[model samples]
Target: MNDTNSLEPVTAAAVYRAYNGGYFKTLVSPEQTGGSFALLEMVLPQGAEPPAHLHEKEDETFYVLDGTVSFRIGSKTYIAGPGETIFAPRLIAHEFRITSSQLHFITLLTPGSFWDYFMEFSTAADAVPVVKAPTELPPADFLMHLINRLNSQYGVKLV
Candidate 1:
C-alpha cells in the first residue's frame, strides 16, 4: 500500500495531514485500480469542514467509522453516525462537518482521478501524525487564493 500503491492483500496507506489537523489517506488509488476509483480514509476533528462544493467528474460515497457528521448533499440535509453512509454525486453541491467530537470515515470516489486533488497536499508518510494542529484556516487572503487555484483546475466549484 505504501510503496506499491496496492491493496490486494492490505497494507498501511501514505498519509496527508492538512495544516488544520484533518487527515486523508488513500487506501486504494486510481492508478492502482486502473482508473476505476479511489478509496480514502479521513480523520477530521470538529469544525474542520470545507464550504459547500461539487465535483464535475466524480461522485463520492462516504461510510462513517466513528463519531458523527452533519451533511448537506444537494437538496437533502441529514446527519450520519457510525455505520451510516452518504452519497454525493457529481455536480451536486455537498459539504459535511464533523458534528461530534471528531469523525473518522471512508469515502469512495468513483470513475477517475479526483484523488489527484488530495495528492497535491499529501506527503508519503514516514509516520502518521497524532498531535492536533491549529483548526483555523490559513489567513483568509491566502486561503481564498489557494482555494481558487485548486477549484479551477479540479473542476470543482465552491457553492
Candidate 2:
C-alpha cells in the first residue's frame, strides 16, 4: 500500500471536456486513495444528460454545488439544488440532467472506476463537443459501440 497521507491538489487546468458538454476534473483518484474511491467535480450545461446506466462494481454519490439538477434512480426521480446530495448504489440504473442553465457538482465513486471511463470517453476522437441540447445529436453507432466497450472494461452497464 502506498502512503495515502501525501497531499496534492488538482487544478482547473486539468479539467476534461466530456462529450455531453460537461467539464470533469478528477480531484482524488483511486491511486491517491489506495483504490478506495475517486472524487470528481463536474460542470454540466442545461439539457445535458448521460444515458441511464449502472455500475456493477461501484457506488456513486453526487453533491450539488450550484444550479439545479434532476436525477432518475431506478423508478424514482428527484430534483436537487445547491448543497444537496444524492447517492446511487451499485447495480441500480441511474442518470442525471442539468435542469438549470448550468450545474456544478462533486461526485464520489467507491471502489473507484468511473474516472477511467470518463477519461476514455472524453478523449475518444469521435467524441463531439456538445454545446447545446443533446436531443438533436445524430445517432452514432460506432460511438455507441466504443462507449459500450469502454463501459464493459470499466464495469459500467449502459441501459
User: TM-score for each prediction?
Assistant: 0.82, 0.78
The per-prediction tally of clashing pairs is 0, 0
- Superposed by TM-score, candidate 2 places the C-alpha of residue 13 at a distance from the truth, in angstroms, of 4.7
Model 2 stretches with alpha carbons more than 4 Å out:
1-19, 123-139
Model 1 Cα lDDT, one tens digit per residue, 1-159: 346665464233434544246677778889999999999888877776778999888998999999999899988898999999999999999998777777889989897587887777555544664535355566898787758766887788889
Name the lDDT of candidate 2. Answer: 0.78
> Which candidate tops TM-score?
1
- lDDT for model 1 comes to 0.79
Q: Write the per-residue lDDT of candidate 2 for residues 41-60, one digit (tens) a residue.
A: 87778877768988889999
Alpha-carbon runs more than 4 Å astray in model 1:
1-19, 131-133
- Return the clash pairs for model 1, or none: none
Candidate 2 residue pairs that clash: none
